[model samples]
Target: MAHVRSSAIRARLDWVRVHHGQARVEEVIGALDRHELAIRGAASPNLWIPFDAYVALNTEIDRRFGIGDLSLCRVLGRYTAEVNLPTLYRIFYKIGTPTYILSKVSAVWSAHYDSGIASSRPVPDGVIIRVESFATPHRCMCLSVLGWLEQTVTIAGAELIDAREVMCRLRDGNACEFRLLYREP
Candidate 1:
């Protein structure tokens, strides 16, 4: 499986546990093996983990909760929307209007996603984010990521903001594109 920074995955589990309590978390991580590649418990925010683990954890959460992808996005969206990121992003994301913040989206996303996924760059009005595919594996990830982007901007002082999955890779398009629109207060 591919590898991704642990910060992206561990934080979500921590959020789930912190907000929902241990029993709910144990319901998922307890049965999974924490291998040298992936730790079962709270992983270091900077640790490296197999991407499969991230996928597995989400899949397990959905199966365990009997929830759909949109609901899962809500869980993560609320968590991310409410918290300020580290010093760098807290300032970077808030310094500009929603459009400007999104113009810099690639800066932060680059840290979490591998190059194979796609590339992001600022467009004239919004931003263009392309992904490798929109298959089953990427469906939930795309939705949740969109949710995160929406909330991230919302907290950053944007009075109005919108993100849409305009193009889908599953639809035989070149890549999945998220169009960002916003009005600054």
Candidate 2:
């Protein structure tokens, strides 16, 4: 079974509690408990947890709070970047151009996920990221990545125009591809 950093799960739960209230979070936690997943309040951020549990948590969040289209997963992902990146990494975003920042996504991929290698290359107005070798892929995960990349460029002081997942392992078979277009700012 693939594993994900516990921080990912914690962040999602935190978002729910903050936005929906303690009762909603408790409800969500109850649902997850049925799946045998535990979200201890003091769980270590560096600890590893089952990736499917992470997915299940996201699925529940989307089902309860998200638009039926799963776009809220993308929003949650962008929120993750917003909340998580501005602290220690704010300087990197300020100093780097969008291209410079995006090109380094491959290096950062392994920090949050134990599966998948993200590779990127410069395109005309943006970057193309391909997430390959992901042992388990799902639509929620793909949308989250797409949103993260979009927010990343915006944080790097670029004006994002469009972003899309052109291919997904869930629908297309092998890898997931994301295209993000930006205007220099």
Candidate 3:
């Protein structure tokens, strides 16, 4: 398969992260969820893959390759801004980072831009809302997502001093909390 240029991919990811918006996040999340479900033997009729499975597969691949590099994981996290499944999948296998896969999924619901496709709406600030769970793997999922977000900001020529957990009201009446961090050049 033809590969996306690393620089171009990075630029696209940076664009999405910097221009985060709610609608874009929803759209990308829907797209990514659909793609994940389409994969063979994903999980169930709901078409959701377990977060742990996602992490294990990538971790296994990394172990097999004997490459302990985290660059691929970082890149995959960056790519989530675009909801580019093909690129994400390729990076998952090529770079072998479990954190990358989880971050990509979270980015689908957090980052409001599609690096693979153009959008007609304004991008929102990359605000990540974490859903707490007792599942250990799910916790890892949250960390991976935060890691990716931080990496994305750094790649965009900004610095993220700290990400503090805070509750933010969503469109729905229910309130969700995520690690809120500020960025500056």
Winning model by TM-score: 2
Q: How accurate is candidate 2 locally (lDDT)?
A: 0.82
Residue-by-residue lDDT tens digits, candidate 1, 67-109? 7554575456446545527777677667766666665555555
Q: Which segments of candidate 2 are over 4 A away from where they belong?
A: 34-36
98 Cα displacement, candidate 3 (Å): 25
Cα-based TM-score, every candidate:
0.78, 0.93, 0.33
Off by over 4 Å in 3: 1-46, 65-75, 82-131, 134-143, 151-181
Error of 1 at 174 (Å): 1.7
Better of 1 and 3 by lDDT: 1
Please give the CA lDDT of all the candidate structures.
0.62, 0.82, 0.37
Number of the predicted model whose lDDT against the real structure is largest: 2
Error of 2 at 154 (Å): 1.3
- Arrange candidates by TM-score, descending: 2, 1, 3
The sequence of per-residue lDDT tens digits that candidate 3 reaches over residues 16-118 is: 3456554543343344443333223432223334444344433332333326442334334444433433555544434533223333444444232222221
